[model samples]
Target: MRRPHGVLRTADVEHGHDLLPPTPPTTVGVIEAVATGSPRRVVDQRANAARVADLFADPAQRQRIPRIYQKTRIDTRHLAIDPLEPEFLEFSRKPATIRERMNLFFEHAVPLAVDVARRAVENLADPAEEIGQLIFVTSTGFIAPGVDVAVVKQLALSPTVNRMIVNFMGCAAAMNGIRTAVDYVRAHPDKKSMVLCIEVSSVNAVFDDDVNDVITHSLFGDGCGAVVIGANQVHQPLAAGSVVIRDSFSHLFDDAEDGIVLGVKDTAITCELATSLPDYIYQGVDPVVSQVLARNGLDKAAVDLWAIHPGGPRIIEESARSLGIPPEAAAPSWDVLAEHGNMLSVSLIFVLERMIRDTRSAAPISTGVAFSFAPGVTLEGIVFDVIRS
Candidate 1:
């Protein structure tokens, strides 16, 4: 029998390889690696948007929601809770209590966090036991011991591993998580760190006729993103190849707090999103790019790829306009939003993860600039250098 073309034996799998393509030889540099976890549920935007619009109880708002959902550029998303589930959907008939919402948060977020955390660790080809610290980021819910403890237990990291939580930080929480981990690794170069972001935006669903609730339902989704950064004294691979954290920067638009908001009321997370978000985001991100680039003695032209947060389609356009870059530069952000509606803190990291892979095998891998926004009108940015062999 003729052997299959280039068939290889599947035995000694002990070699140092990861999910990502290995870096070419003659160059060993640090890299930042990431992975994503599957959401518990999937939702179709066009259909769910219509259903959520009906919950408005007002025909005017119902008619308006479709246009808004269509304009969002999101066709689908993964949700932690089913929108059509009787328990969650009966909000108009009987509003969901805080306890019920919190229940969904715990039930869904715990396992989701564990899965994403594991994927992150597995991607590194580094042992999980060596992770010096665990950082958890979430804006959708709160707990006493919080999601960090559960994540460590499931991931089986050091029981004594340092734990930190970046909660209620909104979409930018993942950046803060990475920033915290980077700070730790900088101090303890021998140690590695993991940052996990899990958002269950569906659990925060509001069942009332409020315009904000309808808008929130139409916009947000659920999922988790995890990353492992090399902080050792020597440059370590954050992923399979040579991707290093060149720099990261964040800024807050003064008096712009009113633009986006997340709050808790009677158990479920409450949202206060402004319609003028695109204008605000465009205005906010331009300076952030300049500030981050200038500090590194670089400019917009030096960036080969962009991990822009797709807070929305309009926001993506605004981000591109703000940076004065071509519309294609922000294409990846829009792609993420289209494939999966904004997953809050989990959203931007997804964009970055793909950029990391794209850099590995495609153009625009080097000098990647990542950007995401959170409440407090905060703009978080990070720069990555994919040093290929």
Candidate 2:
């Protein structure tokens, strides 16, 4: 059956409350630049796949777990600091019990973040006055004078520029940043916004031999992605196929907080990701997307592009299967995962930037959906249409 347009038939929200206002006719431009701190080293996936097999040589783990890990298609990952080195490992084990690992993590993470933010702003042709807001998203590390303050100092954005800092939310937090910027543009159509996401996933490493922790250690990489979004007046024209923001929807699953969590224990940060994540996505996303489309008076078939967070191979596959999206629709996401592992919140934007660059053909109106999952078992989605020049 064909689904109704972007209206809500679901029980979550009643019909009378004020819906978010439509995106203004004003155009928003996006500039994406990525920076990494990993040593100039690369990991070969073919060899790592063999190593994984050898490590989990036990019968059951070898059979069931290795198959799932192999599906991630991650050949090798880059680390801010090598994980195999004795000094790093020793630091992970004990650091005089006085110097906390969180402090050490922040020391390495903040500078990289500042550098990426500067590059993104510097790449823009417009003067600093053109950017009205700056939003920073990160879950990897925290410092007193955070990215918001750091970015302002480094980029020299105007003192009047609005600033927001979002912390602790995991991989999907970037969607929240985009949603905030979209709302900012809608309210003040002439204003521009910048979003910077930096995640030093290596810092959060648990240094444990547990299978789940090992899997996480192997899957995440350290990277930062920064983008500028706002009126195009002072910036380069958005490329021919750039994705434009239209609308967004967010849903938090009930009683599922325990399913995914990131927290600090002793001097190390630990991530607890339940194996049931695939099941959560399978159960919730279909209805959520349907409701989002219904509100915009759009049907599922109307969506022409999909930019899903490359959380992992199984999560991506489950999302595709649940949404009935073709493999081609999610190819960019897969490519991001293969090339960069999960850079937490930055991964979605990385994939979206690629889609915007690759799309060429035109239709009446093309809609793209970007979705991500994180702690709180939250599923956030944004729907945007291509703006013709």
Candidate 3:
């Protein structure tokens, strides 16, 4: 059965109060690395923006309007070296080399993922033995034992460390992973859980030379982000600064599953994104946001921080406009998109990490709303408070 919102709320009272054992503070630590194999061949947004426009202007794809292809302020996109190199045209032109392609892709992807996970975990002073759980999230590549195993092998974490893999959920899966960690930390307030969100989207590219493929190719880049959540009671100086996970809420739009989907066909994965996506978010997101805030006894005006997924430029604009979020409130999201094309599941976490890192003063009883939309037409939402240590 689907759980109703606000069925429970813990961690509300002051730290030393008798209502509950002091809730262990949960904080986010981020580490991000650009994939080495994916070279930035085309490093300008305007040029790519024009390429994006031309791709959708084809007569056969006239129905796929260019307007829906939001003008990404993406100055550059990373591409795998062999794929982008002129000499690789022979390999690119071929079809039906699935096993060979998969092998090549994983070889490059795994190392970058390991590097990203290692760097991120190293940011936390807690020894590997103390990390009781490792949650790995990704949609672009698949491998047995996966990132969880890779992290365990590299970090020398306990063999008993609880491991979970959240896969194929698209951009919103990152929140799902975080929500899972939140529940774990809430249940075991003495344990620490690490979340590693890595997306090597460039590897999943389909070279169909079609409009849908072009848009997908142009909009995504390679990136990975890792975060750590721990119980607040242990209280190891609170990391000097951290964003506390006060509460989180998720809402899924059941009727709109066809609005966005990512699926595999033959040797390539296709991203089927409807042009009406902006309309869907604009029409649906407000009520969900309202319901989520109301359940927390918050009004629209009470939310001071919004770490929304930068799905694209139009999605971001429409979401902000639909939800009545101010321009300043959406600035960080826009900045992320301009600097790095959407990294799918990992993008929202990156935004949240930035907010936590950049806070210089005590943030208002700040309510951060991080959300993203994807297949199943999911609207994954997470709300948290930024507490000053």
Instruction: Identify the candidate with maximal TM-score.
Output: 1
Most accurate candidate by lDDT: 1
Residue pairs whose backbone atoms clash in candidate 1 = 30-236, 31-238, 31-243, 32-238, 33-238, 98-267, 359-365
Candidate 3 per-residue lDDT over residues 147-175, each given as its tens digit: 66876887777888899999888989888
Q: What is the lDDT of candidate 3?
A: 0.67
Going through the candidates in order, what is the number of backbone clashes in each?
A: 7, 12, 4
lDDT per residue for candidate 2 within 1-389, as digits (tens), equals: 77564455545256542365644444444333333333244665555444544545467755554555566688666667665556766766663422355576667766777777666667566637777888888887766666577667766778888988888788888888888877776567666677888777676565544567567766887777776665443234555555566677789987788767987666566677887888888888888888889887888888777888888887788888888876667888989899888878988877876766663655634578889987999998788765445
lDDT of each: 0.75, 0.71, 0.67
RMSD of each: 12.6, 7.2, 6.9
Question: For residues 251-292, what per-residue lDDT tens digits would candidate 1 score against the true structure?
Answer: 888788888887877747877778677778877788878878
Candidate 3: clashing pairs of residues: 24-231, 24-232, 24-233, 25-232
By TM-score rank, best first, the candidates go 1, 2, 3
- The window of 10 residues in a row where model 3 has the poorest summed lDDT is 29-38
Better of 2 and 3 by lDDT: 2
Please give the lDDT score at residue 63 for candidate 3: 39
Compare candidates 1 and 2 on lDDT and give the better one: 1
Model 1 error, position 253 (Å): 1.5
